[model samples]
Target: MIALGVWQLQRKGEKEALLALYERNRAMSSLATYPELPPVPDELLFRKSSVVCLDPVRWDPRSGTDVKGRSGFRMIADCRTGAEGPGVLVDVGISDDFTPPAWTGGIVQGTVVPGPEQPTLVERLTGRAVAARPMLVADQPVAGLRQSAIPSGADVPNNHLAYAVQWFLFALAALTIYIFAVRRRLRQ
Candidate 1:
């Protein structure tokens, strides 16, 4: 219980920091320069951009499901750049029923970067040589919408105080019961 209480307090602090960071990033102006991209650490995950095509290919086939729910294929496309520079990984969300063409065109709006195992999610799927797309490219999303993979869950759920109180109350009740039982035994 004590540990839970401490954890709850820590969670509160983290949630506050996350919200503050989000607000600050939301207020700042958007930039297209590479330097500007590195400085905005907070927006690095979701910063939007317009990218042209480099190559169209399949991505993330291992993470597939057959349940009666929404399904799609993960396709990768390199964002076109002015000079010979790094490309962003474009996650193309396709319906499970739909058959993706070998050469399709679209825009993606999420930062594609290297994971622990692979340079990009596409590489994780295809296992060929791949690099990460770290910027959010607004143009050329294969899914016809700007897709962002931000987690929508709340940062904090403050039920620890109540839980601590309940635990204390249970402890007190156990002690009272023990005392009452001893008194009754003595009287008998």
Candidate 2:
């Protein structure tokens, strides 16, 4: 029982450390600075000052409930350098625009803020505006030449404390059962 309790404490400590690391990373400046030019960085692996352009693509929206037991729209965008080079597929949120390329290409310039919320996307999935709407991709510009918003990494790590407590309770129950059994056998 004592050993189990100790293990639970250790697990809690590890989880705490992980949560702290994530928080620290989130607090860092959301700068999109990158040294490399053109050549696409690994998907979701970009540094600051990196320039990314998305080719025309279509994807589902994030807000709507999925009849097939899945929610969120799909947006497919191609990441690449120059006109013809290595291109990578970027799956962005449904609130983002991931429509096909128009006569004017979409270009976004900003410090690559790390995390999923670095580049915020907004779109109306339901209602009359949906069908005649532009699917927003991760890198696509929002609202006609307007800069996209980036969400803070505030709510990224969630429910750690609750999880730790649950684990601790389980360990405690196990210890209690063991002690009760031992006492009963001794009396017998």
Q: Which candidate number maximizes lDDT?
A: 1
Residues 76-123, candidate 1: write the lDDT tens digits: 344444356554445454334345435554433433222212355676
Top candidate, metric TM-score: 2
**Model 2, which residues run further than 4 Å from truth?**
1-54, 57-76, 83-104, 110-149
lDDT of 1 at 65: 24
User: How well does candidate 1 score on lDDT at residue 178?
Assistant: 95
lDDT of 2: 0.41
How many pairs collide in each candidate, listed in order?
12, 23
- Runs in model 1 lying further than 4 Å from the true structure: 23-28, 33-40, 61-87, 104-140, 143-188
- RMSD for all candidates, in order, please: 8.9, 11.7
lDDT of each: 0.44, 0.41
